[model samples]
Target chain A: MDHLVILPILLPMFAGALLLLSGRASEGFKRSLCLLATLLQLPLAIALMAQASGGLQVYAAGNWMPPFGIVLVVDHLAALLLLVTAVLAIAAVVYAVRGDDLLGANFHALFQFQLMGINGAFLTGDLFNLFVFFEILLIASYALLLHGTGSARIRSGLHYVLLNLFGSALFLIAIGTLYGVTGTLNLADLSQRVAQLPAPDAPLVGAAAMLLLVVFGLKAAVFPLYFWLPKAYAAATPPVAALFAIMTKVGIYSILRIYTQVFGDTAGPLADLANGWLWPAALLTLVLGTIGALAASTLNGLISYLLVVSVGTLLAGLALDSHDALVGSLYYLIHSTWVCGALFLFAGIISRCRGPRFVGRLVPGPALSRPTLLSGLFFLAAISVIGLPPLSGFVGKLLLLRAAETGVAAGWLYSLLLGSGLVSIIAFSRAGSTLFWRTDPAAAAGGPVDNVRLAAVLALLLCSPLLVVFAGPLLDYLTITVDQLLDPQEYARQVLSMQISTSGGGH
Target chain B: MELLYALTLGVLTMSGVYLLLRARTFPVVVGLTLISYAVNLFLFAMGRLHTGKPAVLGQVAEHADPLPQALVLTAIVIGFAMTAFALVLALRAQGELENDHVDGRGKR
Candidate 1:
């Protein structure tokens, strides 16, 4: 059993703890240390992804058997997400190091702790442990969201904190109910138990499943629960908002992971329980998110709504619940996380160039110092986000559109998916023109752009075309990932049958 | 006994929710704390309430389900920390924004 599985979680835990204690250290030292840890994570994630491509790998924490102790399970999905997170971390940390860290105390430490929580959430196999990791990540996020203090951040922080605390309470009730009914909290064990659940217990389990969906939906920014996201993400600093691109995906992952594993097709009466509810929510989320994008007055607000739109797209693909649709959803998930993250950094850059008076407000402002370079980057990002042909977003949407089944469902999927694409084109172009083309000629030219921050933006922005480059191999890997996901019994067999052969070492 | 326990949990949650929905920050924080208490109790009750049962196994025939107890402990710690954060955030918002309204707008 390779202990490499735990390194993703442990590396950041230790680094974050040390950084937190050494808050008195110089910024340069903290930057190097933070950069070193984030840089180390990329190769580690790739190695893990390679290892995961072979099959499902489970690491029993503390050498305890699966049903009794906490376990970290890495499959194609987990490994792929870990790599995405690592790449995004490099971008976010690089951006934060360029003066954003100085704007707040303990930024580096909070960042690492955030990564630890995210990585743990991605890898955990136990339901209770998932809640623990959720709190860990949420706690880190509350502080990070309030970084670079402003009245806007503080006010948004209050709502974000209060709402998530309520959500946390609900999450515990769901976990407690599931444990009460099934007598187990291990996801694999719960799946097995759910399959044999008595008729009476099924309703209780169903209720619990709904509560879990509500909590995850709030986190994922589903239609009704997504109200807090736009304000909060827009108010957040660039790097923090960039890292949060993966945060909503964390909710999407939980929805897919838990729903598929615990109450999937094999769970008999309770199988696919949440799909009925998720279907409408996914569609409404799409419509509302697109409208929000169109109405957004600020550049960051536009990007934030676009993030909600991505969530809607991904959730729709999941709600469609077919193999190909899932493939598209997963593909789109990666594209949106990276490109959307880069867009947040773009907001930051644009705000800087626009000067203090106009911060990417979709209005005529001072002419940019580097209009060609900045506009060129904006055009590339806008095109990619709008899902134009030959980019990663285009491919993901194509797969999704192709996957929609015939009849009312396909009609809705095609119209809405394509309609949103067209509307986004308009929204992005309007914002783009106002930002770059409609600048006031008389005003002073904006200051020279920061190269360090630009490099950070390039790191994530470049992945759009890079994903297109790797589309073939990536799709093939995702094909296996989706199929592996559809089969829950194989997962249960592997996890539940781990015998305690060596007492300490995993069997 | 079960009815009373259930009512107590319900009241805490209800009160917590009522306060949580208030416009002011202080009441909202208090409401969140109340909900946390309800959640803790509910989690503890999920293991099936028992009297005079030992938490440890092998000490007595009627050892309680230790898992919920353990889960409750974790939930309590998390809930406590979150409440403190919420209270401090409320205070800071009050100080920074010059009002305690959750939305930061003063009375119209």
Candidate 2:
């Protein structure tokens, strides 16, 4: 029970390593092992979530202790994200088994390695370790992005690679600057130290904080920094793109974690560090992303653009910084990830059914083999994404609108949110009518639908309504998570007051 | 001494940004490497500019902090791996597309 916190990180690490060493194994064997590892994470995440709600749970590496050795802190927020990631991993693995897993050597291995990095990033209590985990996941993603051989993919992959490499360079610079000023890499220690930064050193600390924001912003694909996302995501195969959906949220998670804990409203000299620019940029991001969606000629392009819209909305909530706004953001965050991932998978199905020449274009095509099922799934996902009533998205937007009503930017937020929803409505309606109504029934009838892939998409699509159904409990959990996030004094105390074995300190 | 370090960082960063704006892949890869070098050096300097003292405790009033060195070592290794991966990707793009331009064509 006490060791549950490390299992999320360690299980994937060991699984990934084992998969790497067993290169001669059959594909089926490797995949099942990956599935088992991912399945184990769901219950483990639940247990960690339960335990974390009691208090912060810290596991010091090598038993050396807090400020000196590495620590993994399982608070409610980390646990919630872990659970969400684990669910997505399961769906992606199941979908890949329908044949996308054969794209490259050891795809399962890299997937697990990616999970290891993501879970480590969420769980680690140290800043430098977060950088290491970012690189781990990123290198894995670079390889995954180019999983198949195509000129278009390699072209976009190059841009993605170079851009992220640049982001990483800035990340290192930020961490170095922060360490130089604070002399500690442990997050809990840094939180206390950052609040007490002397006047002479305050500017340096503020610079470090802002640079970190830029690095994370690049990851999250904020307004000016998001140019590399749409094309890169569109070029990847469907299952891989679905898995990549959660990757952006990692950036959002970090922003929420750092700002609320280390750079909160009470930050001594650097209070409201990035707020001046954040909401305005987020609003612009929302506008640009929706416009991009409307302008997108292909269905994948539209979905990717919608992803940008979701991030913009989430950031606006983050900018508000009110408890209600955060609650809405967390709820919206989960809903968007699930729905976005499902849309990517559905795009694959749509493209496969329509043939490669007319891949998910908003043009007339032959009717699908299972037109009803395909169209039904598409309608559900589209409705949810466009924030129509009775779906999780509507509930999420309602909460966010209510939260925004109390903010200074209420007028702007209301116009953009509603306006974006209207634009998506027109876009999705046009695409849907062209896709289902205009296609000739004879030409599109014979494409064989893979049941495994169908089941995987169905599972994630089902989660949208399930989210709405269980909104009451989920909001309860998110409220506690936000409360835990805002109240960092207790986190600092818990992390700092751990029993340390002073004699075994060998670094 | 600080001026020298800051100037070196600035020059490397400027050259990196310049190359990164190029339309070719190899130069961009080189630019990434140069930027990482600058970042690594900056991380090393975070421990402060210590000259002759051992990294461990010594008779001197202060020793070089070993943590940044460790951090920089990790960064170097990861950066090397990324560079190798990016180079392989560039070579493949060249082989398949018959071009080395970052976008594989004249325009994005």
Candidate 3:
């Protein structure tokens, strides 16, 4: 009955609709409204996260019962992700306001709509509703990706759109198969039904589950399915790309939700299905992503590849399917999303300070405006990203590697993670030296970037060290979250237990 | 009825895949549209393909599963929106780049 479960979604949805309708408003008006809305979201998200830590909170839409009406479930994992998303949402909005808003019309509205989709996707407890939210976010992203009109944006955006459309088709097919076999779309109901599935229907359900994996994998940008990511992401405008850093996490989130909650070891033959292939594929993704990062000539390309690396690392941990591994991945998930968001925005500012033509290339350039701040920020981000000690990235990597010490593919996990770290160190060092140390003294500085942009970038960058500072409490929280996640029957009981009371014996 | 539905679904999906693998945006769009149609039909069939049965409650001892119908309806609308957006993107790319190839290469 806690209404907070749906407020995050509703607040953004209404704000977006209002922004669209008030077409005559000044950009400043729209931007301020958006800023206020996103700022308000932080407190709400924190409260939700706090409440969910105690127990699961379910909100049935329109007071209808679960398994019949749509429900939004806020468990610990969803709550944690909602908080991470809100943080990035704030950063992206601030950046858009400072500069990127000029690129297109109704930027604030589309931004809010994007948040609504993301928040909805994170909070919804129904599979069909998840699909709806995916489309919502995708449509908004398609517009945002093309926010700044350019040949490169349009070209990459087309491929991005088409690839996702194909993925959506696959998603629908999966949902239909699941529904046919299980007769339910509510995630809790689906979990129960999957547990008791008839033997004859096992293959059908397995096929559906595999199909769902492919769809989520495409979104998460796992190994073969990730071809659409680098170009598409690199082509997006900075704020949009920053928001997209979390989009891949949504795929990871769904994989965690569906696999652990619905198809865990209790689902007969379907038990541990993803395990056979997930770890190998995740290692491949890590290798490929690191290689891409090392070979990338442009900083944007490098960061895009690094995003893939983070996904790989997180999925590798998830594939391990142990409490320690899931806990480590969860920590890494929070740390990586923030760092990636900060880095993307920082890369944008770096590019802006360099000439447009020289944006993000490793070649030497004139000293940028705000040389000290930009270089310092870049150094900190580089350290954090490369997993140097005394920063958040190191903590995440340490936990993951430590967790892997007790897993089956300990060698592969440790080697790939360490190797990826080394490659990133070299790649970042080279790019840093090229940008900061190798600068030409007499070459003219690019135009002065606004102070607001620097603040926006710093806001996200500062969170990395803050994570290191608060690692004690955060790790404790993640331990409980993972404990909750590993026990699916408890989750099912909490979700469905409400059904009996809420239904009031109506049936 | 089941065999007929299965055959139609197979044909649609096969052709959809054929167009999807093409080098041009137009064919890809058509392929996407066809695939979505197949998926919609497939979802509708998940309700078990009852003929002449009302989806309304209490209409008979047996009724069609209303949930998949609702799901299909929603999917169709979303699919339409996706197609429109994609076509516009393709048109814009074609006009801007002077190419309709999916890759947007000028000479390819």
Cα lDDT of all candidates, in order? Answer: 0.92, 0.89, 0.90
Docking level of model 3: high
Instruction: Give the number of the best model, judged by TM-score.
Output: 1
Candidate 3 chain A weakest lDDT stretch, 10 residues:
A498-507
Q: Supply the TM-score of chain A against the true chain A for every candidate structure.
A: 0.98, 0.97, 0.97
| Ranking of candidates on TM-score, top first | 1, 3, 2
Tens digits of per-residue lDDT for model 3 on A186-209?
A: 998888888888889989999999
Off by over 4 Å in 2: A406-408, A440-446, A501-507, B58-61
Q: Candidate 2 has which clashing residue pairs, if any?
A: none
lDDT (tens digit, per residue) of candidate 1 on A231-314? 999999999999999999999999999888888888888999988888889999999999999999999999999999999999
Give the Å shift of residue A178 in candidate 3: 0.6
Question: Highest lDDT: which candidate?
Answer: 1
- In order of listing, the candidates' clash counts read 0, 0, 0
Kindly report the interface RMSD of candidate 3, rounded to 1 decimal.
0.5
Could you give candidate 3's per-residue lDDT for residues B1-108 as a string of tens digits? 899999999999999999999868899999999999999999999999888899999879888889999999999999999999999999999998889898889465
Ranking of candidates on DockQ, top first = 3, 1, 2
True contacts kept of each: 0.95, 0.93, 0.95
DockQ of 3: 0.94
Clash pairs detected, candidate 3:
none
